[model samples]
Target chain A: MIITRRTFVKAAAASGAALVLPGTAPGAPPAPVMRAVPSSGEMLPAVGLGTWITFNVGDDPVLRDECAEVIAAFFAAGGRMIDSSPMYGSSQPAIGYGLEKLGRPEALFSAEKVWTSSAADGPAQIEQSRRFWGVPRFDLVQVHNLVAWETHLETLFAMKADGRIRYVGITTSEGRRHDLFEQIMRAHPLDFVQFTYNVVDREAEERLLPLAAERGMAVIVNRPFRQGALTRQLQGETLPAWAAEIGAGTWAQFILKFILSHPSVTVAIPATTRVDHVRENVTAATGPLPDASMRDRMAAYVRDL
Target chain B: MSEWWTYRLEDFLLFSPRVYWRLFELNNAASWPLHLLTLAAGLAIVLLALRRPPGHGLWVAFILAALFAFVGWSFLWSRYAAINWAIAYVAPAFGLQALLLAIGGAARGSLAFDRRDIAGRLGLLIAVVGLVVYPLMPLLFGRPWSSAEVFGIAPDPTAIVALGVLLAASGGLVPLLFAIPLLWLLLSGLTLHAMGDSQAWLPLLAAAITVAALALRRIAR
Candidate 1:
């Protein structure tokens, strides 16, 4: 029986079954939700691993090994994209350590950034980041926080033209400079755009989200848990009764599902140091997402808290 | 683009409290047995300060200079820089403090201790805190004992001890010596505060006490 994504989503929604896509071995766990990149139609898992502060383990072999374990578990749970930046201190090296430890998984989707303030240094920083991840080329290279965006975007676009990187994009976080972020998105033909958006921080819903959808740019949501502050705040609070309808067993999933449920979001990168949390974050993409009404209710419930 | 004022202290902190403390633990592990000598050195400085021999002040300054140099190289540059890119820039300030201590010790032979003064007594107490109480902070905070930041090894306690010793001393250059250590205390205090650690106020409190002692000495004079 030929199984299409639409039919599978319909079957899962109707029967309330696990989201195990076709071609999986019998009895295997459900696969994570995958969304297509708007430019190339390349399907990427909706839940990616973020290495902002969590993976900046420095040169500590023990902590580096622990990060490798998180990566191992992240891949084991069907996660693909792993995002990091040079601005994140030793995070890139720690990711290199993890990739080397994991023997460089084939399913890896490496997303890196060129973060230097000097425009001339953009290509060199990209090369250094590529070496750090041990990947030949990044799937996406963003101009981090929109620093030196004009020159770096030109360099990134050139790299994309040369097939050095699969995608070119820009990012901003903490809701800083939304006007500038939107201006760049409007001006440039970006393949991806990353910014902060969570259940409570819904400011992106105003313009950026819609702009991304209108321009066919893939959206990678950062700070899905406000760097774990959101989950910590909601900890010990009972999960809403209707959360189960969307298969959100934990608040991590509830928040991630809310981000992923947004039609424009291509991925939500929630960082964690624990193997269990990585597994939990990946499983968030496996379950049925909240519909528009349920999404509103989830937001309202968290906002009320 | 000049909207730098919008950023908060928490925004600059890239690592969590867990990672920050782990750096001390790892530094302690990497520099074992040396901690014993550093601790002994700290005690020796305190004993020498108490004795106040004709030239003991120079000895105290020399010891503090060595400790500052060691922490600058070992902890700030070697270990903490791995996690915090900003520390690489701050490490040179530690070297500058060390140089000032050495130069001041050689040039004026000032920094003589007078336990009779209120500032001197408070300075000795602060030094003792840096040596004993600062290390015990891990235990109080429910962290592993291995992560205890030691004097002469960890930057925070080393700066505290240096500030304390500088406070106890009498010298024209003593105030100059206070600059780097006090700046470091402020930076680390801000860092800890950003991490939401309950003990965040310790360094800041230590700095404030040093400033108060300096004021008290000024008033007494």
Candidate 2:
């Protein structure tokens, strides 16, 4: 009953998930959804790739090759954003290796973070991130977990002004400092903000998501699967028949669709190392999105399980 | 505020299950043929213990020292240091264990090994398990040979071997040499369990056996 155009728009933004267009003939592959960046108005795929625990393959060529295939699969499925941080050991270089192997994917929307506290070290770290990612400039450079946010924000603002990075944002994955985060969000001129927000961990729904929408800041949702715990819990469970209406054939799509249905969310970065999982995650972008009532039903269904 | 305090052991791990398991596979790939050398050293120690060879304890001590140093430099420092920054600090602990083992062996001239006793028999069993049997654990857990953890090349079996060697020797210095390996077993066991690893209980089981064997030895004395 709470159907709205926002659902279709958010689902439409997920360009990589749908294999066929919404109005395509019965057998045609659906078009992936796309969302716009709030500040630059640049459209990005709703389903981005995260490289947190998944891409930290320190100096292992065999694993690096595996990650390369995952990247290839991601791009082939319409992924554009690849988020990483210096804190995830060797993840940046691993991404660099994968990109090199994949011939430097043109669609790569590189996002990294400045993690350390020392303001002087921020630029050098960003430079290292560039080298590790093998990029001339970054699309986004965020203050990781808001560590020394004031100091890093100034540096990030300068970098943005200098054309070193296209966007400046702050992130918090710890899920505790919402009060401080909201305060910063209210004050800072951030282009984006990332935090943990999944179907189960909906704490962001009350403040962060609403604030992001109100402030016109793009929201990148992390831990979309609660770090794989939700999948593990839902293992072997059957998808509801109603889910087919939204094109969610698998639980991956079900959960991802729930997140994508949110009006405030720009993208949900689910980190996966397996190529098949990448394909599954990308497919979540396609199909009909759940409306507000359906999202509530989805939440209730998951809770019952 | 109390969330940080409520965090479980698995909370701090920076890797997924697949990535964590892949580490072993990659580590095994990087440290090939060294498995043969470790196997040989483990056998030599078993033979030395069984035959009551002169300076058996010294030989076992040096072998353990080499294994500790190998694990320190190769596994912890070179490989694991990349993922777990804690390895950088922990690598020196292995180095310290190696040094202590070397000094203890040299100062004592030789360890007294008498298989005639219960302690000696139990010690030999523990050592042989580390050398010969431990590598087979991966097979039980449905892991491939590529991820098989072996002594000298892998920390789990290496620590178990060192603990067995320490328990077999008769000296006040044995306890000093036992400290690091004991701590490692507990740490590795808990970590593995937290990660939901199939062989999670092996290190802790080995540690428990080692303590019980040591206690039995004391009772017999």
Candidate 3:
């Protein structure tokens, strides 16, 4: 009776038979669709939560509480992966504060990054991140933007071996350092790699993603909204008529489903400050994802935009 | 601690350029028509500097002090402190500048209009630019009027105006007034540059011109 990652995901998908809005349904909301890491077969919800600028509240209790509600909504919708970094000012600490207010849900799959040139300071930075998230150890610690990666990757590898962190990886976002990122994905024995991938920014689809699949590394897609550029550009536009077929009621869901449709993508973390946006984001994981043709159509539709 | 020195200018920025500018837009939205008053006040300060009435230094000081205090209380403390922790420490520096200006003015510090010199003329021109031209940046950039940055309400133009005032004034207290504004211009310029903001170069240029004019004035003296 050993339940594998596949069986767990199947059970979770079966539970997501129907979508319900907040406070409108009599029962707990539908569980999100889950994807398994190709490397270790550890399953995670297809949609993860990112804490970049959205959670950097800078000690404001009201804003902190608001972020806590966003976390609450995320977990309530069956989200597990909450990705953050030390480079993002006040974001990690705010995540800790939010988790504190939310009573530290057990589903938390905390992911953080070390961004320092000094190899000696890498452990201290990760320790600070641990303190910030109020977690005993991170589930994943990545090299942010590949800065001093040789130094930090060594630290991450040792931490992974010692179980201080469960997984060691690297990340680049906003399409920066992709050439080097691709090289690392090919050469290194990393467990996970995160980079920017969305409808408009298809550069990752060219090499990084396929390489992740080939290398059996878990892929986390970031900047799914292209840092608000996509949303702002598509503002005032109606959702596509066929969006309802895939259960995408909003653009957030629509775009997230497009990312999740990729076979290599384990999770897409869309950061947000608003609780409603979090609900919208997490609900993207609840329904049938777009297939290859729908993904092509989605790309064409956004290209014309 | 060893890695602290490796940080780039972008590392200090808490948000994107869009979010940063959106703060100015929100500030403008919350305080509409206050920009008009700020424009008028800036013009009045320049005019008073030109008139050189008795205790005119104190008059300009009173106005400049009030502007710093307003930026500290209304903008930095109320708006920015919510996002950036470094600004909370910097807000008190603005308060300190306000006090310094108060003391200099009360002590009859010399801050008279001097248009005969090139530095004086250049300084006055820069001041007027801050008073009139700074607010139009949002409109020129295709942004709504709600994103307009003005003196007394916003930091950039207020700092520029302060530099202009210092450059035009005939006083030993010029360096004291120049310190904080210049530091802010450098910091803001770096931050804006890192954010890929088009206005990034403006602060650096303003800082250069202010310093050059002040240096020219000193040489002439």
Alpha-carbon runs more than 4 Å astray in model 3: A1-26, B1-13, B16-158, B170-221
What's the CA RMSD of model 2 in angstroms? 4.3
Model 3 in CAPRI terms: which quality?
Answer: acceptable
Every model's DockQ? 0.66, 0.46, 0.23
TM-scores of the candidates are 0.93, 0.87, 0.71
The worst-scoring run of ten residues by lDDT in candidate 3 chain B lies at B1-10
Error of 1 at A12 (Å): 19
By DockQ thresholds, what CAPRI class is model 2? acceptable
By TM-score, rank the candidates, best first.
1, 2, 3
Give per-residue CA lDDT, model 1, range A98-188, as digits (tens): 9998899999999999998999999989999899899989999999998989999999999999999999999999788999999999999
Best TM-score goes to which candidate? 1
Candidate achieving higher lDDT, 1 or 3: 1
lDDT digits (tens) for residues B64-156 of candidate 1:
888898899999999899899989999989888888888877876556765558788788889998998898987789999999999999988
**What does the lDDT read for residue B174 in candidate 1?**
75
Sorting all predicted structures by lDDT, with the top scorer first, yields 1, 2, 3
Q: Give one digit per residue, the lDDT tens place, for model 2 in B196-217.
A: 8877788999999888887887
Q: Give candidate 1 misplaced runs (Cα > 4 Å).
A: A1-23
